[model samples]
Target: MKKYCAYVLLGLAVISNAALAKEAPLVSIPTHDAFFNAIKAHCGKAFQGKVSKDNVGNTFGNAKLVMHVRKCTDSEIQIPFHVGDDASRTWILAKTGAGLMLKHDHRNEDGSFHSSTMYGGHTVDEGFPQVQSFPADVYSKALFIESGIAASTDNVWQMMIYPSRFSYRLIRPAREVQVDFDLENPIATPSAPWGYE
Candidate 1:
């Protein structure tokens, strides 16, 4: 009888474990969150990047580019984009009920917002896990026009993640810019970006 009781207790323990496992979620988020998860995977790392394509010469082609996947939360991520010694740009990604929203935060060295700051777009379609694109939003278009950069009204930004590289790209009728970074080799984090501690 004692041996029979031991067997029943062992079975009960196994059943309990199974029940506990079922109560816990198998994944933190749904499967459709692939693109967002891909970007979130490198939360605390910083990577050096180079200009892969620049149809128009600007500060980007001449400066050293580094992208830091800095502050992150469940619904928001802030990545600082450094060009040489300038820390004036940050890319903000936020999850919304419909899709993702991308915003740019441009600040002066003294932590003041620039005249043409906080312009960006939102994801319009269901992009793949490896890539996502944001088209200029209504506010962004208006801001561009008001800021006297009317040509930027038609801007679109895209981000892609691969096994060994991450890319940031800008597409417009007259301009195309892309920067590629090595994901497999991350360098030391640079100094805190300007306007940030």
Candidate 2:
């Protein structure tokens, strides 16, 4: 029965292929959860930072810089970035359902919101656990355009955290600003940010 043998061989091949598919290991991409947890690991700590690279100009020349990982929640982390005595900026990192968001919260000395505040970006992909990059979002681009800094529309901000150091960086067409903080040495926590206080 040649016809019967052919049917049996076809069935066997199909079953074999199904078995192989079931035995194959699944490959998964690195998730935002890993990246979020990496920064959460350093809550309630403060570190001093210095401008490591500034190709644009000396915007923060010789000013004492500090970042305090002050407030943390299950879905958010707030870091106050202080430069000298000017404690008007805070970095808010939040876990969105799709990915992550980084927002800059700027305030005046009297705890009033600045006109050009709450501008940042969202992650477009599942970034690495040690580092993440956020391209300027629509809101940020609109704010930049409205504020006459349209060149910042192409901005991409990046943050890196490791066992020994942490870094915050900004990149655009002709501008690159980077600040590195020593994680191994914890510094005294600074005062609350302008709006937070």
Candidate 3:
């Protein structure tokens, strides 16, 4: 009789747990697909940008900043970031199945890879459709440490796309840089990025 009672109680507990699990609500979070589509919507265009904020210093002071959505594929988008006459930087956004990845491809005037190139991060969460943030990933941290810029190990890059504006931002412990582009006004597409031409 005692064994029967214990078995009944265990069955009841299992049923109650299953009931509770079924009653749990579903959560909906913004996805990388949405964010990627948001930026992909502006492909094949060029826009002018300005240094909106730079607490570290005016590294791009007064330079004519431009961003061109140069190439787009099903799984990747490459945007060349032009600062004045220098066109050695490209922002590559690619879908990693699990999430999105952001990589900075830097090249020299002769189309050679820079010492600190191809360093970026991957999204670790369901960021919003208009914005996605990527914290420094393992590769980026190691690259920073090896390149003697260990302070960049904590870098977090963010990209925001809206109807009229798009922003690229970099955040670290003591550094913050942002550039906002005017999407409302499309500019002539600049020359291809280094090694991309």
Q: What lDDT score belongs to each candidate, Candidate 1 first?
A: 0.85, 0.89, 0.90
Off by over 4 Å in 3: 1-30
**Which of 2 and 3 is the better model by lDDT?**
3
Name model 2 segments beyond 4 Å from true: 1-30
Question: Model 3: how large is the Cα RMSD against the reference?
Answer: 9.4
Residue 197 C-alpha lDDT in model 3: 74
- In candidate 2, where is summed lDDT lowest over 10 consecutive residues? 23-32
* Per-residue C-alpha lDDT of model 1 across residues 1-197, encoded as one tens digit per residue: 99999999999999999988774332323422787778789988999998888888674657888999998887788899999999899999888757788899999878899877778898887787888899999999999888888999999999998889999999999899999999999988877776667
In the range 1-197, model 2's lDDT, one tens digit per residue, is 99999999999999999998773332233567776777788899999998989996787977999999999997899999999999999999987666789999999889999999999999888888889999999999999999999999999999998889899999999999999999999988988887664
Count of backbone collisions in candidate 1: 0
When summed lDDT is taken over every stretch of 10 residues in candidate 1, the lowest stretch is 23-32
In the range 46-141, model 3's lDDT, one tens digit per residue, is 999998889978889788999999899867999999999999999999987678899999998899999989999988889888899999999989
Return the TM-score for candidate 2, rounded to 2 decimals.
0.83
